[model samples]
Target: MSAIQALSRQLYQSKLPWTFEFNFNEPDYIEQYWTHLGGDLTFNRPINMMSLPSHFIHEPLPGASATLATISHQQALQYMSAQHLQQSFLLSVHQYLMQNIQNNIQLEHTAEHFQMSSATLKRKLKKHQTHFQAQLDQSRLHTAIHLYRVHGFKTEQISQYLQINDTTNFRRAFKRWSGLTVQAAQS
Candidate 1:
């Protein structure tokens, strides 16, 4: 479904861990099968939801309407595969940026690292509706958030990690990115 594909794309872009919730009274044979297949199954929850670590592919159960379920499963598979491919492309860009966060990464440098011309890389990113600087800022914002919230890093430490010479600028940027002050985000 388009809805599933959109959610998958969003999850892939965010690169956040999540848990799946299912609404079932008990663990049925079908649930056990999915669990054996490495699916995280949480039953008797208030809602039915799927979590995507990176463009998750939902597998249909065996015990469903043969005709309708088959059609739906095929459609879902197609969407999932397509979304996975798109996410892979974006991941390549983001990974390169994050890995070289300490260095002053430029488009040409990144393109050379990836073995492509800068123009070509730009075109590819354009196709994805993102540019290098945007990705860089997003990666930094996520890292800063994690360091501050998870690792309990102070604002000055986070600013140094992000290569922002001024803690004030980092604070302003964090507020703009998350709509929360540094103290608020930490809390």
Candidate 2:
């Protein structure tokens, strides 16, 4: 969220003195945060919302940004575009893997789902400094962590939910993923 605010500031530097409006999915904002936002603090967020996405928006006054912001604008655009491409692929892969966590994961099937050959998927992931296994491990580890710590699920339950088929195997896999025993991890 701070990244979004800073990016908005740079992108709208030409329109300095712009009014900032924030809509947070969280119920409240810290008053300290308003000091850095550099605009009027007006609250127009939804009420009684359980889940929503937060937004950092800049509302320039009338006739603001009449001139170009130039270097900052160009740099911001370049950064955003590069980040979008690189992160989009990884995010897509993670989302797909997460949704099918209970199933046996396979690189070939994942490649097919992405409409590409297995080798092509491997190449793309390598370019991003990762491979299929790392992504899969990350997804599994996160799910395991959440289930174990947050939901207080037993090892057997987690193993069954993740379809690992055996409690001992799940324990070993969990140790490998997190470098800690399940009980130790909870502590």
Candidate 3:
């Protein structure tokens, strides 16, 4: 909410200054949660609505810099898709795991999602030189990072969301996954 204007100043060109709106209608006590965002961000609107999806409307990137970045990203995607079927499979698995992160994810259940027997899934993963446990860990790590960094989720919230049940174990897992503490990861 606070940093978008500064960040946009560096990378994008637009006709008018950008405005932001958060749709989550919150109360006064919740104001403390946003104070760290900086005092300049006190502007709020539609003070009555319960909730709605937020969107950032921006013009298309105008320069060759955008063109080059887009082309490079597309090339990387094509290369990864053609050369790493295993990664594509693991990516699907990662998405499934993230979607179900708050629940206990089991090998058999993940196999069911892919329309295969558990053994078949294990064998396929083994061929890829990886296994289900590693993917689960990766997904948990990713979800934790996204929650904490992008959504401002606290350790307790992220712990429950990842189904860790215990905060200390979740802390250790986050440290192991990213080599940084949760707060440090934000920077």
What are the RMSD figures for all models against the true structure?
13.6, 12.6, 12.9
lDDT per residue (tens digit) for residues 43-118 in model 2? 4321111111223234444445644567668888899888874548999999999999989989999999999999
Give TM-scores for every candidate, taking all chains together and pairing residue i with residue i: 0.52, 0.55, 0.54
What is candidate 1's lDDT per residue for 1-187, written digit by digit as tens?
2355445446455423445555455554765535432355565543355554534345433344689878998998899898874547789888878888777778899989989999998898899998887787777777786676457788999898878889999989877665667776554
- lDDT measured at residue 118 in model 1 versus the true structure, 0 to 100: 90
Tell me, by lDDT, which candidate is best: 2
Q: What are the per-residue Cα lDDT tens digits for candidate 3 across 46-164?
A: 11111112343334544648668889999999987898745478778878988888888999999999999999999989998989997887778768766764588989999888878
- What lDDT does the true structure give each of the candidates? 0.69, 0.70, 0.67
- Give me the displacement of residue 54 in model 3, in angstroms: 11
What does candidate 2 score in Cα RMSD to the true structure? 12.6
| Candidate 2 ranges beyond 4 A from true positions | 1-87
- Relative to the true structure, candidate 3 reaches a TM of 0.54
Candidate 1 lDDT:
0.69
Model 3: residues with Cα > 4 Å off, grouped in runs = 1-87
State candidate 1's TM-score: 0.52
